[model samples]
Target: MLTHKGDKSGIRSDFISDYDDLADQWWDPRGPLAPLGWIARARAGFIPVAGHEQARLLDIACGGGLFGPHAAGKGYRVFGVDLSEMSLREALRHGFDEVVRADIARLPFDDESFDVVTAGQCLEHVPDPFGVVAEACRVLRPGGTLVVDTIADTKVARLVSITLAENVPLPGRPPRGTHDHRLFVNRERLTGVAREHGVELELLGLRPRLREMARYAAGRLEEVRMVRTKSTSVLYLGVGIKK
Candidate 1:
């Protein structure tokens, strides 16, 4: 994994500002934020919650607490962290058990503080994804699980997820420039980072329901569906087991 010095000054100020501007839309299923909610719900399916009823979970860059309530419902003690105060406030208003404003790369918790750590659709927004992954692992206890999902670095992903989804100006689509194509991460790199942090990684591809994508764009989150796939050319999910 890549190492960085000092605090999380490497994080982009503009990214936080952008999320802050959209904080109010987080819970609106029919809003441009529905896609994130969809992704969060889909990713939640992969978490091993059956025997972890009392596990502590920390979601880094947990904008609007998308995964917070769901994880809590599964009996996990959930905590969320984000750089945007507005986002954190929205998360609190949405009933997150705990929400903290902090940098993803410089988490406020102590080492081995959590039984599970998750960062969903967040790596692409940071300047140093590897550093963030290391930080996630740092706070996880031995045998804990670390989950992550991010867009893939591929031409198709750029053209579809970024160019079309962001810049097309379609109704319900997120505002343009919401994503930076250059920051997309591939499965190999993500798993490599986890491996370096003493975590065994498993990579999976996310195949969002096509019909659900349309529903999400139309702000109908209840109608969206997501499925797992073997192809990681568009989006990928990962689960790392800390040793």
Candidate 2:
């Protein structure tokens, strides 16, 4: 992860500013964050419907509420937390029941408070993503589910997620400095951290459906679908239940 210093790629180390700067682009299909909207739909598929009334879900680093609409009709009161003020404003304007301006590394809720917790596309930006995982788990109740998605720390991840993804002139290409490969999460350590916090995680590889990507690139499709894959060398999702 980030070592509190600049990386070898010469990209700026302050990643949070990007969210604030790109707040308006969060809902644009051809914007940098469009892929996040696609991933949000995939993540929603893993969440079972609420079994009881007032089931609570905490969405960490919820930028512009990309996960909100997909999470609706699931019978949960969604709460979002992010450090970006402008992003939180957009999140509140979306479907989040409540929005809190807070850092993911230091969650403010009590232990076992939320029935579910989700951290998406945020861990890779921190100095200690595992610590953020622990915080996510801390607020998650026993029998609660925890879902997270992030880029894996590997040469292939750096090549695809950062190099080609950012530099290529694609429809959903993120800003050039949006990713720092040195801060990518280690898959093994991620699972271990969740297990240590009483959650046994199941990791799944995820990527855009190639045909859908092509259609989206051609402007024939407004959105592309993310599908499961056998490889987790790059972007991946994790789902687990608290033991």
Model 2, runs deviating above 4 Å: 1-18
- Compose the digit string of candidate 2's lDDT tens values, residues 1-243: 222344554545644344777888899999999999999999999887887897999999999999999889999999999988888999988899999998888998999989889999999987789999999999999999999999999999999998899888989998777877878999999999999999999999999999999999999999999999889889999999998
RMSD versus native structure for model 1: 5.0
Candidate 1 lDDT score at position 143: 87
Question: lDDT tens string, model 1, 124-169?
Answer: 8787888899899999998888989998989999898877887666
Best by TM-score: 2
The TM-score between candidate 2 and the true structure equals 0.94
lDDT of 2: 0.90
Pairs with backbone N, CA or C atoms under 3 Å apart (clashes), candidate 2: 1-183
